[model samples]
Target: MKTALSLCLLTMALGGCGNIAAVKSFNTPYGSPTSGDTARLRVIADGMVRAVPGKDCVDWYSPGAGVIAVPQKGFADRNGESLGMPKGATAMQGDVVSEVLVPAGKPFTLHFLDGGRGSYNSVTNCLGMFYFVPQKGADYEVVVHGYSACGVKLQQLGAEAPVQVTKAEYCSAMANF
Candidate 1:
């Protein structure tokens, strides 16, 4: 009886050791909108990306609204090419291409998690939070990269350069507490 109890406790403890956080699926309104009050934002992630609603910054420890993006399977084979990685960066099997609508001129935040090897008990997992304001009727793309050190870049679709974005200020403060 004692051995069985110990085994059960061990299983429970190990179950919670993974680096990935539990998040719901974020749902965008059906039918693409052509209004100037909204903008299209594409999220590309090798692991997963969570869209946290509201302008306020949220920390990593806290759960967000839900996961908005995940890695796409067989995307590279379908396209027969890569989806444009930054110079000196290695490409994953397939990056997730998820599009969603965001309020124009409003602040939006995203939490990025690296698809590190081994979902459970992974030491290479990295997390990053970034916020940006979208312009009306414009399309934007957010690319997330890295494992041990995650990086996020935002750029307007068809633009040659990436736009400047800052990390969530609240997350830093929360870390101090």
Candidate 2:
């Protein structure tokens, strides 16, 4: 009984220890108002991934650590390339920007790579997934933010108050991604 209680208390205490907070959404969406063009995606990466020097950030996605934000469907195509690592060295802090050209006119899932024990999130732990659809002629921004125990949380930000809330929902379809 004592051991169980100790473990519970420890978990509660460490719950807020590590967190990826204040993920700023982009100030402007990319591109102009074009009728038949694909929507541009501005992914602001703000989270924890056990960064290993000299390894492609995508490599860390396996069992250990890495940070990623990409389209939830058709992630890999043409050349079988999936959206994972952003285009630069993994920075332990601050925002890393990466853009993807999404076919406009519909909604899509955004996947965030929330790693294992290394992340240190003790609440709701798992892959952080959410739903978002891009608007034609406008850029869409999403924040990949979370720690291990907290799993992952995707927040869509608006330029002003009453931020338009993009449906941050989950579905069985995620299993297909």
Candidate 3:
């Protein structure tokens, strides 16, 4: 009985060592915006694998409202490309930069450009990945920004408050060359 009591007391004491805070789940309220963050990423894979580094890469996707954006003529494209990496290093044209949605950590594909230049993101002699996360069911204009493979300025993105709630979305805005 004494051992059991001591164990219980010890356990309780350890458990109460710090302030027990409640963790909020990621189930954000519909249309309620969270911290809309951005990142830099190199195109990894695409729908069909090719002889290019960014041929079949996973891409960055922003969600909100009822529209998804990318670096196409307008928005919404199954296959896209991101010059977001070292030239001839890996990234290539025709690589889709609109597959990944709600990228946070690790590595994800994205249409990366510095300011509004048509260049790929480069980390020394290799390609890099960028991640972006916007609010759910909200209207957001995301701009993907980053430095060119040669360490030049490159990024494009925008975020707007949701006018009408919609399902999760993904897109990649084009950066000027």
Candidate with maximal lDDT: 1
lDDT of 1: 0.57
Q: Where is the poorest 10-residue window by lDDT in model 1?
A: 74-83
Clashing pairs in 1: none
TM-score of each: 0.59, 0.41, 0.20
Q: Over the stretch 38-69, how does candidate 1's per-residue lDDT look in tens digits?
A: 77776666766766544546543433344566
Off by over 4 Å in 2: 1-36, 46-95, 117-121, 124-126, 148-158, 161-177
The TM-score ranking, best first, is: 1, 2, 3
lDDT of 2 by residue, 39-88 (tens): 55555554322211112222212221122332222222111123443343
lDDT against true structure, model 3: 0.27
Per-residue error for 168 in candidate 2, Å, reads 6.9
Q: Per the 3 Å backbone cut-off, how many clashing residue pairs does candidate 2 have?
A: 2
Q: Which ten residues in a row have the lowest lDDT in candidate 3?
A: 21-30
Tens digits of per-residue lDDT for model 3 on 7-29?
55654654432211111101111
Please list the C-alpha lDDT of all candidates, in the order they appear: 0.57, 0.37, 0.27
